[model samples]
Target: MSRNPRILVTGATGRLGRLLVPRLLARGAHVRALTREAGRAASLAADGAEVVVGDLGDGASLRHAFHGASHLFLLSPISPELAAEQIAAIAAAKAAGVQRIVKLSGSHWTIEPPGRSLSGDAHAHIEAALRASGIAHQVLRPNAWLQVTLARLAGELAAGDVLHAPPAFPKVAGIDARDIADVAAHALLGPEPSATDSPWVLTGARAVDHHEIARIASALSGRRIVAEPLSREALAQRAAQAESPYVAQVHAQFAALIGTGEAATVTDTVERVLGRPARTIEAFVAEALAA
Candidate 1:
């Protein structure tokens, strides 16, 4: 890879992509951001990224976006069409002669049986397609994002000192999205190419259940927070009131994985890739509360 590879970053306006674009720019990489809405990409454009309007559904547009790009950071939102869109993007990338691809995948996906989780299945399909494409690729499979998990309890935390969730939710070493982005930047820019068809499973320093998360949040927020376990029916009611019925069903499936303790497995992949310890829940809580 060249010192200043022309990198194409998809989903630039999303959480991880927003963090990633700036980091890539800081390293003197020439970044081209692909977004569905050009207007939303203004900040990226202001930050020296060549923002291009494109849609994953449009093959011609994807080809245009991939043009002249040596490296591709492939990220997409979770949807039923996710696998199809990523496969399309992979084809475009290969056609454009892109040298490397770093894909954002999901943790425990390899262990998941078919039809376990919709999102996991979609990502697994995409990973298979990438391998078949024969591109030099690296996959970052991160555990449940700490920010998303905390956001679910934000209202409860603000109203009182109790954090509630379904009972028997297993421990998970949830990782910060920023840490995932940092590892991605390293993989995209590092001289040694990542092992082909290999994936890096990222996690926090240690696994913790909701009780531990509550304690950590309380310590950081200067409040005495306690964990309140709820029944499956109660959790269903809460999910129904909070989001669409379909989304609630999806959440239930993921919660089932946690209930089974599958999401708690930890790996030292982040430290191995970034040469630094992964961020902890305590630190994430402190920074989030401060912000």
Candidate 2:
């Protein structure tokens, strides 16, 4: 893509969007950041992005945002109908003559165990939409966020000595959100050629289980920690009590995955994309514990 092309970024007010917009601007791309809440678009405006009020569910709004845009950064939020929302947005982008789209598809979760499940189904629909639109696109499937470990292990980290849930042997290939954002930004503004349409999987440097994370946190904080396991049913009940139906469902699914140890495999996808090793769990633990 040319430098300073009119680029439209959906979900610009989100976590990745916040970083992605600024990164694109640093590459000299003029951006229109689309958000459902106009007030929250202030950050984008401050970062030299043209803020547009819009929703993925509304075709007219998406059309308006896609207008006069050459490249589109399509980031569908985590939801059951992510694919449908993305397809609608892609249709609008095609009508607006957009040339490129960078989409955040499924995670390592879906990639490792491909099926007709919710996450997989949603990503499939999005890919279908991009293909049907005949738009040049890149699909990124990242691994589970390191934040998941941080979120669950925060209390332990703060106290400087405990593993809140999961057995010590439970392993996961945890990735940092910032790294994922970097890869997304790189793909959005990087050189494109015959290799533009391939699917890229983003990941952190290493695969780590709770025991390793606990050890890292211990080293970082200079304290001893005890790893403890929680039952899947208990975690699900806790999630349900927290009033997050979606999280409850995910927790139950995760419990099943954990039982099968299907989440243990690690991939070299991040190295292929970024031309370097991904961040390690130790780095994540140190960074998150400090935060």
Candidate 3:
């Protein structure tokens, strides 16, 4: 890596990438954010990041984006092709002489031995590729996101006082997306590279169930908000509305893992990496409400 690394970031328009890009820029790194649409990256280009429009499925675009990059921060949308696309990205990075990479991966709860979620299986395959590629890399396995898990409930609260939660584990320690972004920035810009063998698992400071989340919302909104469990039919409809067949399968797999023990464990990885306690659910809800 050069004294000043030029970092190429994929999924730059998504929630986590939007947060990570500015953090990398603040650290004086040369940030090149990739998007498939030129128009979507207009703001990124305006934010002093070198925005490149590319697709993981498109090799010419990947080559163009990988040119002269010292490191790659890889993230892809949820799809069945995730493993193949990311593996190809690693190969392209190596061919471009990019020596280091950081990958945002699926949390442990979503994973199983095999034939589970496409999301989990994809991450496992890509992680294996990273090991075989010999790239200086670190994988971050972030737990359930507050933004994805609860922000919708908060948004729904604006219209009604009830949250229709699907069946899930009793208590889940969901981490904030901001915390994950911070860990990613550290992994990418730290003084030295982390071992590729071990993945960093991220979680929030505490675990809380849907009922507890309702209480928090009630407390924050100063109104009575209830968490009503979604019926199996409603849940089935929700899964049916997924964007693709592969994603629908992934959602079904996720639904199957809801009652497992893995979803409730909390880790100190965030505090260890950033030297501060992890962000809390209350804070995440407050921010969601404010937004």
Candidate 4:
């Protein structure tokens, strides 16, 4: 019998990472999870993952985590240093003799006229670096996360019927993070690397506008939810109130992309890889609310 691959999973405490770890465990892959905080990794350790305390910025820590691992699932938190962090991780994986790396990249990262989206530009740079490294790699570029939208607007959805946000013009086929995790698990544990170097664009079953989202929210929450389009300035003000100015700026840029209909494209990558339909936004909202 062939032995299961030893996989090193970065961002193991993150939204997708948390889900992917258990799925990998279920598949009988030997999983090692890297996290900065050992305290936060206790639950993953309990779930049979070999948790390693490591910082993506710290070369020594990442080298230690990558040691003896045959495969790697590379994901890092969004930050100004995202590109640097991922590149460092890739270098560490290569030095440790990891055979393959499945990186969680971003949708529209390959879009022309680069640097349009800060996050997309960073991911593109990392992808380029990965290609230069000559490592066997596959990239999964998921669209706007339904979980992020739901979490950001949870309070508004619960308190009132109005779902206020910037205009949704181009529409978005928002994907569930859990589906991304499922796909990542398959990529890490699959018998062979992807046939091509082209990144896979993962999306939900269909594109949806805010109106559709409001309707779904209403049905799920048993309340009349209305889509309220806010001005860019208004959206920025709200984001600033909730988070940092940088976050507000990023959100504004994303809103502009959505307004221009640039983010509405859907793809069959998820179903093609997993042999099952991607989870719907309605289902994600329902599960999140229940939890």
Please state every model's RMSD to the true fold in angstroms.
2.3, 2.5, 1.7, 2.5
In Å, residue 164's CA in model 4 sits off its true spot by 1.9
Top candidate by TM-score: 3
Return the clash pairs for model 4, or none.
170-261
lDDT of 3: 0.86
> How high is each candidate's TM-score?
0.91, 0.89, 0.94, 0.90
lDDT of 1 by residue, 1-291 (tens): 655699999989998999999999999999999999999999999999999889999999998999899999999987767889999999999999999999998676433677888778888889899888888898888988887877666567657787775588578888888899999999899855645546778888898988887888987877888888886687667787744555566677888787888778889988988888998888876765555
Order of quality (TM-score)? 3, 1, 4, 2
Question: Lowest summed lDDT over 10 consecutive residues: which window, candidate 4?
Answer: 106-115
Give stretches of model 2 more than 4 Å off.
Answer: 111-113, 152-155, 167-169, 193-197, 231-234, 241-247
The 10-residue segment with the lowest total lDDT in model 2:
111-120
How well does candidate 3 score on lDDT at residue 151? 56
lDDT tens digits, residue span 98-140, model 2: 8888888766566445562456667877877787777778888
lDDT of 4 by residue, 37-144 (tens): 988989999999999999999998988999899998999876777899999999998898888899998776334458777878889999898888878888888888
Q: Please give the distance, in angstroms, between residue 250's alpha carbon in candidate 4 and its true position after superposition.
A: 3.2
Clashes of each: 0, 2, 0, 1
Order the numbered candidates by lDDT, best leading. Answer: 3, 1, 4, 2
Sequence-dependent TM-score of model 2: 0.89
Question: What is the lDDT of every predicted structure here?
Answer: 0.84, 0.74, 0.86, 0.82
Better of 3 and 4 by TM-score: 3
lDDT for each residue of candidate 3 in 18-72, tens digit (9 for 90 to 100): 9999999999999999998978978888888998989999999999999999999
Total residue pair clashes for candidate 1 = 0
